[model samples]
Structures are given as C-alpha cells and as structure tokens.
Target: MAIPTTNRAVVATASGPVDVLTDTELDVPTPGPLDLLVEVRAVSVNPVDVKLRGGALPGGDGPQVLGYDAAGVVLAVGDQVSAYAVGDEVYYAGSISRPGSNQQFQLVDEKVAGRKPASLDFAEAAALPLTTITAWETLFERWRLGADSTGTLLVMGAAGGVGSIMVQLARQLTGLTVIAAVGRPESREWVRELGAHHVVDRTDLLAEVTAIVPRGVDFVLSPFSAGMVETYTQVMALGGSVVAIDEPEGVDTLPLKWKSQGWHWEFMFSRVIHDPESTAHRELLDEVSRLVDAGTLRSTLGTRLSPIDAATLQEAHRLLESSATIGKVVLAAG
Candidate 1:
C-alpha cells in the first residue's frame, strides 16, 4: 500500500468543549533519525487526553492531537532505527512534545515504541501501554520494588487502568503486599481477582489501611497528593515514600519531614520528551509484552468505540471526564 500524501487526523485548536475536537487532514510527517512512522490502528482515551482537551494541560499554540496510547503497524522507520522493521506491529504512549497518535500516521521515537503483546489485539494492546508504562515506572523506577522489596503497597486509585496493572505488577514481580483502595462494591472483587492482597474502602483510607497492615504502609500511589499529604503522613511507615501522579504544587513536604518520609512524582513522558536517549520505555513495554503473553498481566479495556472520528472522540472525552469509568475506553483507528 502506498502512503498517502495527506494524513487523516483529529485535531484540537484552543480546547474549550468537545466540539473543539474535529477531524481533518494534515501532512504525513517524515521520521527523524530514530523515529518510526506508525499507521495507528487503535487508540485509547486517557485522563491526560481529557485534561489537554479542556486546556487544563496546555500544549503548543498549534493543532493539538490529543492521544497517547497507541497500537499500530510500522509503515517506515528512521535510518537509525534497529529494533523494528517496516512491517512490524508495535505499541507505545507517544511523547507529549509531538503530534500524537490520534492521527492516522504519527511519528514516534523507536526508543519509545515496543512490540505489541502476542496475546492481545489492537484495542486491547492500546489499553495497556500508557497505563502499563506508568505503573511499571512507578513501581520499579520510583519506589524500586523488587524481589527483596518486602513491605506493603497501598494503591489509592486501585480500580482504574494504572492501578489495575500496578496491582498485577507488584503481585507478580515483587514480594510486597498490595492493598487496593476501592470504595465501590463492584470493584472490590475485581481488584482481588487482579492480585490485590487486600481491598479497602477509599472513604477511610487511613482506618482501613491501618487495620490491614497495622504497621503502616511502605509506599502509596495516591492521585490527589496535596489534600492527602497529612493523612498519608500518619498512615505511612517511618522512612516510607508516596509516589503521586497528579499536581504536586500545593503538596507541602513538611508532613513528610517528621518520619523522614518522601513524596515523589511519576510522569511517564518525562524521559521520552526530556531525556530522549533512555530506552527504559521500550524495554519496559517489551517486558510487559512477555508478561501479557505469559498470562501474568491482562488488558484493562472497559469500553470500546469505533472508526475514530470527531463525535466518537467527543464521547470518549466525556466518558473519561465523568471519572466513573472503571477501566480504559478504546477506539478503532482509521
């Protein structure tokens, strides 16, 4: 198949409402020295996509393509690319700095792309990469959980996409006890099925977690870091740390001082956009592919949409914004 001169894409300009999201055609981008021109087959909506669409997370003053998680086929590779070929299947959470995977064709660095899991199709594969990379980086890189790492890990947002995969990763890769924080009755059994050693209501995180651990949790992945800092300080063990995925601006470190505790942040795109030389993203994705193929990990896709257009994308943005979505919502790309 010959590559088209113009690429079909969904683009946003200022980002006020879902109506701002529109379908259009743009030039097919040329790959850089280490980039891959991927024909995106499927994409999943993320919280960041919603944020970016609402102008909460601002992008360049150009046509912003709001997507990150992608499962696609490689149509071409840059001169320096070695790990993948033209016809290979791949998946990745593309960099925040470039045009995103919502387009028909997008340029992603080879170091940020990995082979799609053999066990899953495009929509399922799309559901994993962003959340998988986020969970992997948070567990292994930030908190340094390993075979020798024996302690309690309390995941505050445990039923969501990242939390779902994080539970499985911690259970399979380390010796730590995973405490999944879920308020709804619907999610309790689900988290347990995903390998959570303990389940607690998020309404009273401190009381429920204390009853389970009794000695305080070693690490936590709390979403709203600023408001929960004081409560987290009380529930955390001495020298323990909290890894947050949201805004850290109002999070005062004063509470962590008494116990010698720490508060860290994990944004999966930090390395890809800022430190382009790191192969950690690709390596982690490949490792997770092995896990998925081996039946140790699973896709967290909750809903599926089709044909990747403006109205469908608007619906995706609305669903994610509601904050009640159990898992990831994916779309079949053109």
Candidate 2:
C-alpha cells in the first residue's frame, strides 16, 4: 500500500478544555516492523483522552493527539506484522504508549488490533475497544472472576463507560450475581437493561449492596476511581477483591489489610505503552473480539458525532469532561 501524505488530527499543545483541542494536519506515520497502519474510521472520546490532552501531560512540546478507542480499516502493515493486512476492518484500543487515534490514521501493533465485531458499525465499534479492554482485563485478568463463584459482584458507577460493559460482561459471562451502583434515577433503567441483576443508588452503595448480598459483595469493580475506596472496602466481603483503573484519592490500605483483601490496579495501557509481556494483551483482546462477535457482548457507544473533525471532536471532549455521560461517546469519520 502507498503511504498517504497528511492526515487531519486534533492536536493539543497545552492544557484546558475543548479549546485546547485544535485541528491540524500532520504527516501520516509509518508503521514499525510489527505495526499495522490503520485508517481510522471512528474514534471514541474517553475521560482519559480528555485528561491526557487537558491536564495529564501539561507543558508538552507539540500537538498530542488524544483518543484511545478506534475502529478502522487497515491501510498497510509492517513487514513483521502477521495478524492483519491492508483493507481488514478492525477495532482495538491502541496502546497509550504513542500518539492516539484522534488522527486520520494511526500505526498500532497487530497484537492490539482485533477484527471489528460484525454486529456493530464503525461508530459503535469505536466505543468498545478502550472500555471493553479495561473491563475485560480488570475482571478476567485482574480479578479472575470467570468461575461459578455464585457470589455477588458489585459494579460502581454502572451507568458510565466502563461500567456499562462491565455489567454486561459479568452477567453474560459469569455465574456471579451482578449488582450495579448508579446514582441517578434516569440511569437505573439502562443499568438493568444491560443485564445487571440488581441496581442500587450510589448514594447508598453499602446499604443497597448489602440488601442484595447480605454479607457483602464478593468482588467490586470501581470504574469511578473518584474516592469510593472506603465505600467499596466496607461492602466487600472478607477476602473479596477490588479492582480499579486508578487509585482512589487519600485511601489507606489498612481496611483492606484487615480483611485480608486484595486491590488490583488495571492500567490497560501497560501492555502497549511499556510493551511488557505484550502477547498477553493480544490474547485477551482476541477473546474480547470473540465474545463481542458471538453476541455475548455489546458496544458501549451512547452517542455518536459526525465528520470526525475538530469541532465535533471538541464537543465530544466537552461532553466527556462533564462526567454525566451515560456511556461511551464516539466521533465517526465518513
């Protein structure tokens, strides 16, 4: 395949809100020996995407493109790439190690790319990669909850991006009773529709979860990392585990130690960013793809924007930052 000259991208040179996310053109990147060059069809706006662009990497030199989830067709492949070829429709959460999918094209490792789910459109598929990867990795890889434990698992903030998928994965893939913690009345129906066995208001997380489990939840998945550690620890059964994407602020491990419990931190980017045991990430995403294709899973994109341009992307970012979004938000390239 021939290389393209330039691609449209949302570039961030400084930190702030949607205004910081600007449009620019840059030379399309060439794939490395083990990379797949993907012509991005759709990209999802995530909190991490906003954080990285808005504040996480403040004082950066040049434009830093920010997007994690993407579904696209392969335009080219590197010499060492064996899993994909040009024109393959694929989706995957590209590694946080490099520039993101806010651009028209991106180079990602073949190991991280999976054939796009047959059931979804580009916009919908774009929403699945990042949050799905996070939920799958956190539950299966980190919490190890695929067994017929018959115990209850609590998912906090069950109406949000990662939680939306986590609820379905738990109910659809595992024998564990699924309890979803949602604060809003409006979101309760969505959580239940997603297959949550029980839905509780987040304001009364402990009481609500205890009402279902009696003892405590056997596992807790905290997608909201917004200082809910103490609440989770209180409602988690003895020896039950808690998995989080980011650490809760000012949380102490003493409570967890007393219960002989465990806390696992899942940074989905670890594999692609650091390239640590890269093959495991490949294996997990492959399984995710299979599950999605089999109809056991669904994409989490709650809203879609068009054109994949600067203005549309900026709006997506603003919406994501509001923290009120029910599910994943995506930008589609026509």
Candidate 3:
C-alpha cells in the first residue's frame, strides 16, 4: 500500500463549539525515530476531545486535531521503532502534544501503542485504549490496589466510558466488592451487567452507600462530576484511597485529613506527555488485549458512527458533552 501525501482529518480551527470541528485534507505526517505511522481505521471520542474542542483549554495557534483513542494497522515505522512492524494491528491513546487520530493516518510513539485485541475489530478496539488506560492506572497504579486486595470499591459514575471499564477490571482482576454509584435505572443495570456487585443511586449516594457498606468503602474511583468529592470523603473508610480522573473546579482536602484517607488523580496523558520513553501504557494495553481475547474484558463501545467525517464527529462531541453518554462513541474510517 502506498502512503498518500494528504489524508482526511477532523481539525478544530478555533475551538469554540462543535462547529469548530472541521473536516479537511492535511499533509500526512512523517514518523519520528520512535514512532509508528498507523493507517487509522477507527477512533473514539473522549471527554478531553470535547474539552479541547470547546476551547476549555488553549488551542494553540493553528488548527488542532483532537482525538486520543485509535485502533489501526501500522503502515510505516521509523528506524528506532522495534515493537511494531508495517502490518501489525495496533491500538493506543496517543500523545496530546501531537496531531491526533482524528486524521486517517497518525504518527504515534511505539512505546505508547499496543497490539490490538485479536478478538475485537477496529471500532471495538478503539473504544478500549483511553478508558482502559485510565481505569487500569487509576486502580493499580494510583490507588495501589493489588489483585489480592479484598475490600469494597465504590465507583462514582459507574456507567460512563471509564467507569464501565473500571467496574469490570475491579470485579474480574481483583477481590474487591464493586459498588457502582449510578443515577438512572438503565445505567444501574448497565453497570451490573459489567460486574458491579452492588449499585447505588447517585442522587442518594451517601445513604445508599452507607446502607450497603455501613463502615465505608475501602477504595473510591470517581470518574464523573467533582461535586461528589465531599460525599466520597464522608463515605470513605479510614486509610481508604480515592482516585479521580475528572478536573473539578476545586477539591477540599480538610475532610480527608482526619481519616488519613488519600486522594490521587490519574491522567492517562501524563505518561505520553511527561514520559514518552515509558512503556507502561504499552504494557498495560498488552494486558488488556490478552484479557479481551480471553473474554475477561469487553469493549465498552456504545455507538458506532461511520465514515469518520466532520458531521459525525460533531455529533459524537455533542453526545459526550451532553453528559448522558454511556460507554463510548466510535467513528470508523472507510
């Protein structure tokens, strides 16, 4: 297959709203020494994409491409790349510093990429990377929860992309009793199917959680709204740990001081941004791929949009910003 000089991409011109997301043709980027040039077959929308598109964060000087999760076939590789070859099927949450997978072809560092699960297709596989990396790092790395650790885990917002995978990883990979906090009846069932041992309504969070685990939960993974931090602090057991992935306006630490509870933030982009040489993302994705092929893990793709054009991406952004999305929305490139 010949590499084209120009390929289609979804570019954010100014970043004010979904309207800023534009479909355009751009020069295909050449890979660096440690990079893989992947022909992107599928990509998924994440909250960070919405944030970046909405101008919540600075958009730099020129049109910025904004996608993180992707599953594709490697079309080329740089001299220093070793883990992947031209034909390898790969999945990754790429670096925020570079142009993203919203383009038909993207250059990703080999250390941040992993073999795609043999059992899943591109769209399904694309939904796994960002959320899986977030969930895995939050559970084992940030909270330092071991596989043998036996305790109850309270997952706030347990039906969204990260929450869906977090519930599964905790239930399947650890001895933790998973208590998922969800607001809607449909979401409650969704989390239960994903291996949540118990479900509590977010509307009545503290009371519902207290009723189930009267003492308090041993660990808390809050991936949703930041307003629930206070409730989480109140419901956490002494020595319990809390890990959050959302950027809340402010979090007060006074409540956690007395109980000696710990709080940590898991940003999946940190490894790609700060430590590009680190292979932690690749290793974790490899594990996730194995689990997925073995049927221990499943993709959380909730919707699939076709063609990977501007309008479809805008719709995806709208759904994500609406805060009503369950699982993930993926776009497949033709």
Candidate 2 residue-wise lDDT, 41-88, digit = tens: 999888887777767763375568877788999998899988888888
TM-score computed on alpha carbons, candidate 2? 0.94
Q: What overall lDDT, based on C-alpha atoms, would model 1 receive against the true structure?
A: 0.88
The digit string of per-residue lDDT tens for model 1 on 1-334 reads 4677989899887667888898999899998889899999999998888878887545655468889999999998889999998989999998877888889999999998889998899999999998888888899889877877899999987988889888999998899999999879888977999999999998988899999888799999877566788998989999989989877576677888999999888988888778889998899899889989999898988889998888899999899887777778999864
Evaluated with TM-score, which candidate comes out highest? 3
TM-score for candidate 3, residues paired by index: 0.97
| Residues 230-296 of candidate 3: C-alpha lDDT, one tens digit per residue | 7777898988888888888776766787889988889888877787678999999999999999999
TM-score of every candidate: 0.95, 0.94, 0.97
lDDT of each: 0.88, 0.82, 0.89
lDDT of 2 at 190: 87
- For lDDT, the strongest prediction is 3
TM-score of 1: 0.95
Worst 10 residues of 3 by lDDT: 53-62
Model 3, runs deviating above 4 Å: 57-59
